[model samples]
Target chain A: MKLKCIVIDDDIHAINGIKSYLNTLSNISLYKAYTDPLQALTDITGGANVDVIFMDVDMPMISGIELSKAIRHKTSKLIFTTSHSKYAYEAFEMNASAYLLKPYTFARFAETLNRLFPQSPSLPNISIQQEEDYFFVRNKNEKNSLIKVRYSDIVAVESLQNYVRIYTTNETIVTYIALSEIKIILQDYPNFAQAHRSFIIAKNHIEKVEGNTLKMVNNLTVNVGNSYREGIQEYIKEKTIRTSRS
Target chain B: MINIKKSPPFIRIQNWLAYKKFHIIIWLVFMLYESVIVGLFSGQFGNLINYILFYSLNISMFYVHTHIILESGLKRKNQIWWKLPVLLSLELLVYLMIYIGFDYLITDILKYFRPRKIGMTMQYILGPVYRAIYFMFFSTGYYFLLKFLSERKKTEELEHQRLNNMIQIARSENAFLKAQIQPHLLFNTLDFIYQNARDHSPIAAETILSLSEMMRYSVDSNKDKDFISLGEEINQVENLVNLHQLRKHHQLQIRFWYDDDIKKVEIIPLILITLVENIFKHGNLLSQSHPAEIKLYLQNNDLIIETSNQIAKVKEKPGFNSGIKNITKRLAYAYGDQSTFESGTTEDNYYKVRVTIKVKHTID
Candidate 1:
């Protein structure tokens, strides 16, 4: 399902900025944009229910904090779009889905959407494949030698420009292969999933998942990229042993 | 924080006996000399009970004479000269009466010893008077010592307070000078310029944005905040790098490497930023193969921030204003012996600066 969102910012340019970013994301669409916060507050409090409400912190008549307090239950997610990180705590207090810092790229916008509503429709084509259980890659660290990498042994793969560093439980092996090429090679295994633009993690190796960071069993942290949050979120939701409650 | 020097003569007079081991020992030694040593030479062994009873009366008179009579008489400074003599006379008369009463009870009433002459004669009064004067003289000296000690302590406390006041004045003066210009106005004005130039001159606007970010960090982070997560400083460092790259037409070769765990490690502000700025100022940034590298990592319990760069054309001590000296001083002030800062050139012409701050976080 496409996420219907509302934008309430005093600055017209800021609203337009959000508008341009929303245009790039296929899964999220802006239903309304309010340059006047008072009108937005009246409309939202009256009876407007949307998937997300993108609010600004510093406004003229009323702040995003005060407005969000009045109509928090109207939206499924409240993503605070602000110029400063000072109001991050306030946004968190209001149970905001994500804190989207201003001057953000299109990828950051998509990341927030994918993280908040992972099951939303129109995400970029992400097809999972399966083939082999193991492969050998040229280890750049050990004199460009071929190293046996069992699918079960892989913890995380990090993209470093043209090289991808594969971290396992015992040691790290740097290979002179692009991350995309490694993604294709590891696609045969169902456990390997891309968490960020530069990171592909083994789902079974995730010791803990806190916010947008994954704690791997090998004692490494991987930051989930904005555009790649859906796959990781889906995997986390499936693996999580939840109590029988909504 | 406020170190006040206090030497309370009677540390606590309410429970004075507990702390007065010196007073108790001196009294014990003097009593031993009078009763045991002098009694041995005289060869007239008195009854043990008589000695004990009479000595207890003398000890009581000693404290009552100084602490009570002397303290009350000298409390009024203007009348102290005459009041002290009157109090001393009253005290002497009271002591002689109590001594006679005790002697009568021990010798005549209880029949512990044979009765002496019961008349108030010169010999009877003279012995008691002499003993009273001796103890009164010693108590007066002890009283004066307490007053002297307390006064000296007051003087020291006043001196310490004055020194602290001078330091406070100096600090506020520095603060007043630094805070003359408001950060809010500076940021808003830059924001205004950035807004005006964005459409026509995008490059200038981008530079302004980066400059404003660094300015905000320096202005805001330095004020009230002593330590911040590496994440905040990393953002500003990236801004600085972007600004330099734009100025040099993207030819500045620099790579900033830091793990997510390293980002959460708290450190004193401006150290990382200053080191980065120093690299840009003195290091050769155009070499593709020898690109400048800044790495932040946690090696066990130590947080290591290392920067290595090639030497520039004219590296005259590689600094931005006060340079690494200010960083060293700040780190010393905050982390003290738990931090180490080293900066110098390697033999192969590469300048490297490594700073390690010892923190309790051991996130590998």
Candidate 2:
């Protein structure tokens, strides 16, 4: 079962960052979003379908904690996404599924998602072992070390020299694997998309769309290449339309 | 927690007994003097008048003598041997004149009174002269004895104070030595863990666990004293050495030795560790082509630790810095006159340091 999530925050960049990262995790399906917590509360309480809400603690009309408590009778799971560790204890008290600290990497994002959606017997332990859906790879320099990166943990792949540097939530692992091979392997995953020739960003990680360009959760801008711009635009417009319909 | 009322009974009883004896003797002598003087000076009206004058003279003399003695900073022997002779001679001359004048008055005013019958007048000259000498000796002796007892008491108090000061200094030094050891141990162990952590070696987690264990042991065990048993301290050092030895490709040659008996004895905690650190700090800078030798040994109830490394040859020679001088100061403070430290370059281009500290049996 997928986690039906929503982004309720005032800061566009933060909301975008969370949206981009959530795109990479197939299990975390974004349902509805609102810039204002009051409006988001009205929509959620007024019969919106949301299982888990990724709420920001700092909001203008109502705080994420306050909104979560207000909608406690409605939603099942509430995950707090903020930059402060001070609110972590408070978030847990509110029965939050997870508290995602800001400036988090893709690996940390995946780890949080794995906790939110617990594994059943049928779903193999892809975190501990590589399944047919994903594969773990690292550079020759990191292969023998403890710095190995799994495909599920890779937020983006950047082509550098004869190596493709795989950026994870924890650290980056650069390997001699061809970018074509990465693109081919990750093509089937809903979260992975070749936004540019040099970059294959996790589609779930798309934070904002300005015309043809896409900003990632890390505030890094990836050009929506002429070929992939149409597909990227369609995916974002469809998400907005679906949320409005819901 | 502190039992203040538990002072030994013997000390309290001794103090009370001494105080009672001192006051009792003073009161007895005062009463005896008053009785003897009152009897000798009361006979007739003429005698009574004469007695009043004699009594006044004695009182004046007593006041003057006591004032001089109490205010004088002179030693008891000087007051007895010199001041008494001068003061008595001066008082005697005045008394002699008074006596001669009184004799003339008795002869002129009392013509009916026989010279033989005037016993009070006859006894005045001889009695006063003899009494004057006797009183001076008595007072001076008493004053000197009290001064001697007070001086002895003060000397004992000062000795006790000196011993207490020494103990406080030893305790503080022990504390400083402990601080020095713990920080240095922490630095080296953290550095070892960091080396593994930076490489992202799978063993980094194990190194962290080992590092935590070492830290827990250091904080828990080294709370009381600056030094631990030689065997225990060496084990900590060995753990650090083993970390480097595990990465043997560095080809670092480390030799450690200590007497089997010395293992039970305790030495300053960080002394040997500092020597090891200095060896690594200097040896790592040396040409890798040349082998480094660090030798630590115990002999003759003294910790003899030495580390030698080939100096990195460069035209711009570095001067002596604070780290070595600091160790020297710490050693001096820890052992005082009981430690010897030497550092220099050998003719064979090897820089060496030799530190020797006498082992002390620490009370567990």
Candidate 3:
């Protein structure tokens, strides 16, 4: 059964943004969206059984923390989506399931959902745009000749000073292109993600995620930066097998 | 000047009234003391009319001797030695004639005994002569005292004004120094860390290097130079973006798009950096669907730096981009009719900034 969700944010833009995020997920569906906190409070308290509630911390009428307290039992899980990191402690005290900081990526949103619902099925192949599965880059070893690099074959891309090393499943390509420029090229691809300050890993090639380190397919280990730990953990959990007994 | 004008008018008027009262009371007490002291010595009391009549003539002579005659005569620098003594002797002679006639009128005509009879006798003339000289001596001292007091006040005012001007000059000089000291210290500390971290922690070293470059650019640009190569500002903007991306682990959804050829165009500095800073401050760059954009290009030889991002839901302090207002004024001063700066919230709730500088056609 798809988990029912409600988004309550004072900004219409934020509510619509949450709506778009909900549209991309397969296991969670939006029941309603609210721009008015007072109306949400009055309606939710009247006894609507919601599976999840995504609320903004800062609202005009009442804070999401205060509103969450009143309707704590109405939903099984509550998540706070705000730009303020200061309210993380308050969210903890309110027993929120998760706190998604505003300006959070779709990957972050999907990751938060997967953590709260570990038993939920994996997300479908959601692509916002249809682009080529591979692109050509001038490999330095080939003497300025362009070689095709598939998106799926990339295990990780590591920055070594001024050059970038692309670790593919078949061959390693060292390009003269800076990692910053390579990042812009891979920005549209969901599989390639920045895991550390100098490393971008393909989410599908991970063999194991032990602590802050990820073991890739080729016995290649990638250390996760502290700030990027959440994104890495979410991807691992999304693929983790959990039974009803657990 | 400031100190002199600080006192209220009402307080000054009260001081003037107090000064006038002090002078009147001193004169009245002196006249009574003279009458009482003389009567005690002689063992006989004089009538009130006689005391009033004599003291009035003496007071009149006291003021006239200094106020009118001495004031004008002493003001003459070259002839004062002869002019002052001659004027004083004439005043005394006129005083003695009046004293003799007044004594005759009182003692002979009215049968009143004179204090000192001035009937062509040496003893009587000597008493009146001594009285006139006593007042004249005091009036001359009073005139010199007034001159000394006024001179001190003039010098005091000049000193105060000079000190105020010096303080103003010091503040203006320190304003330039204040801008450099903090940034100079900050970049030096960053450079120290950059040296130590280069071997072991390349990421930390890279971050520090970018931070130092931006700091150095900011300090150098604040020198108020009229024009600078756009290449330097573009390099600093890239450094700022790289620094932020490092902090965010390369997750910030910001695009810095420009061609290498466009970087050669010369333009003013700080305008592009400030607008980019506002984007990081107030833009929501997390959405892959709505990425924040910073586009720089040349169209029709007009250099345009355009930036736009979706407005964040978080409420910051209002009028946050007041730096944009400063850019408007700076562009107006430098380019006059050749520049146009427009920045505001778009209808789609995106904060956008576009600065276009029209360049004249020139041979490459």
Candidate 4:
């Protein structure tokens, strides 16, 4: 028997990312997806049952924290997905089964799912490419010399003083590589843009842009620097056209 | 009552001696001296020795009397007019009693030493009479000088107390006014932007513009001690609420009513802001089916602001981390007992607050 799963998130990019990661596992079946919590509540109370729910913390009409509480009496397992890492502790407080941060990788997603369902199907091997469309991350301790990542799967690359935090659809990888290096490597991607001094965000994940700051679908926002605003604006314009076509 | 843990033995004794009236030691000393030594003395000692003993006892009595009667334990105004003269006169009267007492001894001794001396009886009779007159003159002079000293001490204490009270009043008023004005304006601007985000993305931009304007003015004006018009405060509120109403998708209606007369009244820069901040922090209009209502006006020199809203029932304690409480403390400090503030939650979960302050212009 397959383990059925549901995702409740208002952000389209986050929902799609989760969907893409789910394709790797054979036994886990995607049951339903909800953007509006009110509609999702109706669907749940009206008899849509699932093994686990991947919930977001922040949303427009109804907050993820409130929704989790409202549905806690009915279900036992809830996996929280969020862009803001601040919500990770809050998820555990809500008694969630797992927490998946935004722009997470397939291997991290597989680990979380494996913990929940012991007999789950094995994920396929993912290879990294080294072209402008791909990025290489070297982990010294691991047997693998260079891990390849697809540019499209990346949501943002956050700078942490000495290192950069690369966020993909399913995994978050912290590399010793500088943000400037990563920015140069992924600069050609239509969705890639540097929104803050410490942040390079994927244009596709942007839900709302206010003033010089842009709020991503992962419920995270990055500021567009005065110096880099012109470049980001062009990237956002181009991505908007591409997304609209898709 | 008293905090015994903090009080030391010496302090307790000093406090008791200074404050407690009609100390038993003073009366006991008078009674014991008269009963024991005066009754027992037969004038065996010379006249100089007798005067020395009498003056020494009086000096000790005067020291205790000066500390108790003149120096008040309260550290404020004190009077010892009646005590100084009364204590001095009593000393002189004791001196006269002892002088007369010496006559009994002198007469007996004269019988032995100057049996044949002429007019001894006349000398004995005049001796006490002269001493009594001398004591009265000196007591009266000392009485006036002590009175002058005690009066000076009292005035100095009064001046110190008055200065301390004035400084406290000024500090509290300044704090209260800052509490009232700062946070209210801040949250109102926040509400405006939040509401604007609901209507149009561009409205959020506009909200930011207004917020920046308010913030810039606040930063500048906070540096100055000048009073601002109540009318200007109301105008700022109008702009904020109007902007908020635009962004609210739910038909959350906000009704505002205020006294036009108060518009001209000059108020401490931030008094109205505290109430507004309270309203916005607790008010949740998104979930409510009906619109929230707010009313503002001045009645009997007090600013009365009333606002009502139906918000989601928050499960946790709505804990007071806000600056409103500081403002309340400040208002009371600034206005003394002249201002009144009342707040409580209703059965419908609608929180209401009424704050009244007695308006008065600065004299200088």
Kindly list the per-residue Cα lDDT of model 4 for residues A98-175, writing each as its tens digit. Answer: 776443445467778878877654444333344566667863224336776678878887763224556677765655
Residue-level lDDT of model 3, residues A84-126, one tens digit each, is 4322335355558888654444546777888888999537443
Cα RMSDs of all predictions?
Answer: 19.5, 22.6, 21.8, 23.9
Candidate 3 whole-model C-alpha lDDT, 0 to 1? 0.74
Looking at model 2, residue B105 earns an lDDT score of 61
In terms of lDDT, the poorest run of 10 residues in model 3 chain B is: B1-10
lDDT per residue for candidate 1 within A1-246, as digits (tens), equals: 678999998767767767766775667788999998899988888866998999877688887778888878999999887665333344355467777655454445677787877777344333333355667777765766888887899999876433567888777776655576688677767888888656789999999888977888976767676567788899889877999888
TM-score of chain A of 1: 0.51
Write down the worst ten-residue block by lDDT for model 1 chain B. B1-10
What is the lDDT, from 0 to 100, of the residue B249 in candidate 1? 46
TM-score of 3: 0.46
Best by TM-score, which number?
1
Cα lDDT listed for each candidate:
0.75, 0.60, 0.74, 0.59
Q: What is the TM-score of each candidate against the true structure?
A: 0.50, 0.28, 0.46, 0.27
Question: Candidate 1, DockQ to 2 decimals?
Answer: 0.03
Local accuracy of candidate 2 as per-residue lDDT tens digits, B128-236: 6775554545445445655666788999999999999999999999997786565535543453453335335534533453454355456546455766777676656
RMSD of 2: 22.6
How well is each residue in B248-339 modelled by candidate 1, as lDDT tens digits?
64556676766555677888888998899889888898775577888787777899999999988784773454878899999999999999
Question: Global CA lDDT of candidate 2, please?
Answer: 0.60
- Runs of candidate 1 with Cα error greater than 4 angstroms are A83-92, A98-111, A119-246, B1-205, B219-222, B315-322, B362-364
Question: How many backbone collisions does model 1 have?
Answer: 3
